[model samples]
Target: MDEHGLVSREFTHRYVLPEDTLPRSVSSTLSPDGVLTITAPKKPSPSAPNERIVPIAVQGGPTPLPVQHEP
Candidate 1:
């Protein structure tokens, strides 16, 4: 409050979401009690490949990383 018993304020906000999230599904709402809500639905996942092979190149020494596959 400066003078005349008045008040002023300003603010900014940002939100980050996953790349797979459906942009058109995003929604937001603000309640009367000063509460804010945001929601978005994810895009359907693509079908997985039955099998895949990845080639690894060896350097001067044995790779310190282990390879694993997930279902």
Candidate 2:
């Protein structure tokens, strides 16, 4: 880089994304004209819980596990 006269160069480009939401898939394309295009699908909605009943065996007897339900 020093030989190419590009040593110690500082970049001023910054991009920040959401911390909570995330894209499942991402697509990008770079044209011959030095143009970059990025595309992402819409965020998906939360799905219903697949309620599963799990039983645990304790020393005394069998205890039914509790299920967590999000309001």
Candidate 3:
């Protein structure tokens, strides 16, 4: 900071990660040029591989509702 104003503010900051949203595995690497890289492994699917989709279609028109007259 100077008489004019701040030339540049700090780019670094702290953050919090919720436990429920965290991945199983995480990796990080720092390059020689000051570049930081972070990666998280994808979680396994909840559904089984042999799972099948069952379509249940109800063939019927909308139920008629009693009409109400309003002034």
Candidate 4:
């Protein structure tokens, strides 16, 4: 009674959990179904200069400039 057919002790009690002797700057908090998300780490922006340009026959090679003819 497994394979998404449920009944493996009710999918291992809805999802096992009981291991993590903590100790590594310990810090945890998740209420999920009750809403409570937190994530941080973002601060680094200073290096600009890229006008973008790539048109060498659609980048399939050949094009040092020279393919113009307008009459």
Candidate 5:
């Protein structure tokens, strides 16, 4: 619970890839309410044999800013 009397929840999802599956990169954006919109790169690369897309949601409070990364 928070000062505003709101309960927080956390969830995580994982993906298992086949021999040909791999990860390329990850990207994310933050909403005004503090929700993060995450996107996994689908483009295939020599390093990434399998590609996966995932979106994570946090239900507690807002962060100061969103973090982003590129391959």
Candidate 6:
């Protein structure tokens, strides 16, 4: 809705990502000329990490395995 109470334009789009994306990495930009660009970097593969940190759980509790480095 515009200030003059009129519908100037509307847009809708559906996109499918080829791979999982990194957390909080999705972004979109609209140029002055009305060009829209979307960017999302793919998530690192399971084998991408060269090093990982193995957390020590307390009394058999759950532990989170986190990657420390990427190769």
Best by lDDT: 1
Off by over 4 Å in 3: 1-24, 52-71
Q: Give lDDT per model, in order.
A: 0.82, 0.66, 0.68, 0.46, 0.66, 0.79
Q: State the local distance difference test value for candidate 5.
A: 0.66
lDDT of 5 by residue, 1-71 (tens): 88999977787877564444335555569797989786664545555557567789877986768767886
| Candidate 4 lDDT by residue in tens digits, 20-40 | 332333343659455444333
Model 1: CA > 4 A from native: 1-10, 48-71
lDDT of 3 by residue, 1-71 (tens): 78898565456765454443445466779797768787765555578888989998886898689999998
lDDT, residue 58, candidate 4: 52
Q: Which prediction has more favorable lDDT, 4 or 5?
A: 5
Please provide, for model 1 over 25-50, each residue's C-alpha lDDT reduced to its tens digit, 9 standing for 90 to 100: 89989797767798988998876788
Candidate 2 lDDT, 1-71, residue by residue in tens: 77777846354564554544455566769797767776665566666699566897659767779999999
Q: Each prediction's TM-score against the native?
A: 0.46, 0.33, 0.36, 0.18, 0.28, 0.46
Q: Give the candidate order by descending lDDT.
A: 1, 6, 3, 5, 2, 4
Tens-digit lDDT string for candidate 6 (1-69): 878898667778887777588647889898988898998898876764577778976686666799699
Clashing pairs in model 3, backbone N/Cα/C closer than 3 A:
none
Return the lDDT, model 4, position 36. 42
TM-score of 3: 0.36
Q: After superposition, how far is residue 43 of candidate 5 from its true place, in Å?
A: 3.2
| Better-scoring candidate (TM-score), 2 or 5 | 2
